[model samples]
Target: MSLKPNIVLVAALALSVAGCGKKEVDTLPPAPGPAPIQSQNQGSQTRIVPGSQADFSNRMAGLDTIYFDTDQFDIDDEDAVALRRQAEWLRQYPAKRARIEGYTDERGTREYNLALGERRATAARNYLVSLGIAENRLTVISYGKERPAVLDSTEAAWARNRRAVTLTID
Candidate 1:
């Protein structure tokens, strides 16, 4: 065979091999489609912002804020119902932790309110623990009368202020 023709054949063979490799790379199966939405969200899907206060509030709805009787740190039957609902929600998100913030009305002294608030928070934490929630996932803090839900000095406002608000934390 002529040297010139042999060289040309070799070059053509090399180019064909390169082209085959490119085709193989391009022919990979199409990337999998996005994962299917969970069956529970059959209609409209609502996106949840995990560990956000807004997310917690949205998921928890009316149960996030549990009101207490004046000068009381114990959880009442009504409060227990709300706490149960909250515990259910918390159980849904195992990765999430909760901060139980206790507050009191403006009637008590600051120090007394602080102590009462701590007791209230602890009370809520204990209730949640009793409801099968892990003790480690819950924390307690007392804001005393400092952070009032309602600013007015009415019975309604005080009633609203004396509460243990459960908030989701990262």
Candidate 2:
């Protein structure tokens, strides 16, 4: 048996074995029936349609927004108080993980803004860690000036844009 013939035989055998194992994947079950839409009167609080509201409320409840002064990453006394409240919330829910997303206004260069945002997130994470939260349970990401909380260029909007947001994950 020459090497070339042997290689061809092996390849054929492998392909045959693979073909034997081929299976028809079941197509996804028919899409669920359309949900019944409910109508709400003008004066009433709109009731969320059941399953849709779960994710909305969960995301809403876990989101925490903290603002920062221009060109600053240090947690000032006022920010410290707010972070303490965030720490307390974490202490209340030991099993949850939180992500600190840092953002900045559009005043600086892209590279500088990214570094600033990262420092801002790290500053917040450090404070949480100092408050006895496990560093592993906290993650940080810097969006820089890319994802502004407010799009306007006014002072008020710029103030809103300089922020770190904490989002809880279970």
Candidate 3:
């Protein structure tokens, strides 16, 4: 009958309704199954089965690796073409991140090769960043002469080894 009682009723209704916005989660269903067991080694990686997206992407667009001249870290016109495609791919899949890995031929000292590898990787990363890719989504690493694409010391082998590879993150 009084306005004060109506106001109190409205306030009580509001208090009741305020908490209804967030529906409580149902009791979770039973586990699908026990988690798969792993070997004792238990590497740092969480996934035992790696993503095949990189392979699929590589098959679709050959933008995985860019070759470099001996003792050079500059991205050539040919490599630029691939890099542009890479930038496009990254743009399309904003969720996908990448790691630019630099590798050098086994010609220089370890220290020298490491420095060269770093420069090579950084060059690739910078080029991708210039193409409007978020810098935070990309990382650079140097493998030096440790992980060669080709093992032999021949000119052709060295040529294949001197390169930067873009590995996609899951």
Candidate 4:
């Protein structure tokens, strides 16, 4: 057999394989604009623009960070309560989207910490979904040991470092 025929056959096979897997995507309705915010600045109303980082931060203060124990990815009761509040905030702003960033302490290998961080972020995201937040509105990223919240080597710093931070996004 000539090589030309083999080339054509291989090309056809390649084309067929390339199109074999197709994914069906879920669609969401248009998100409503941010609700107006009332402020006392000069006795005039202001807007934070819901779904924006500012809005999420403003509404999620003191509840945006979820800490984990050493070498653990589980969400404890305290974190669960915080996550519940975060979920409620998400529910109030249906159009808002969030990014869950996971981090680790400075004691683990980069690879290991990366995986652990991913688990942390995923756990937070899953908890939010279970609380009725739309799954599609959340995304996850892991900083692992690369981005420590505190640079100190103290246990308290490490505790703060091992956390997942939920940030609002457009």
Query: Which candidate has the top score in TM-score?
Result: 4
Error of 1 at 133 (Å): 0.8
Ranking by TM-score: 4, 1, 3, 2
- Cα-based lDDT for every prediction: 0.87, 0.80, 0.83, 0.88
For each candidate, what TM-score against the reference?
0.70, 0.63, 0.67, 0.71
Model 4 per-residue lDDT tens digits across residues 44-150: 55656655666666877878999999999999999998899889888887988889999999997999999999999999999999999989999999999998888
Candidate 3 ranges beyond 4 A from true positions = 1-52
For candidate 1, give the lDDT of residue 1.
53
Q: Give the TM-score of candidate 4.
A: 0.71
Cα lDDT tens digits for candidate 2, 17-61: 887876777887878654434423356344443223233234345
Q: How well is each residue in 67-148 modelled by candidate 3, as lDDT tens digits?
A: 8898899988988888888887788778778888999999999999899999999999999999999999999999999999
Off by over 4 Å in 4: 1-47
Question: Comparing candidate 1 with candidate 4, which one achieves the higher TM-score?
Answer: 4
Q: Which candidate, 1 or 3, has the higher TM-score?
A: 1
How many clashing residue pairs are found in candidate 2? Answer: 0
Give the best candidate by lDDT: 4
Reference-based TM-score, model 2: 0.63
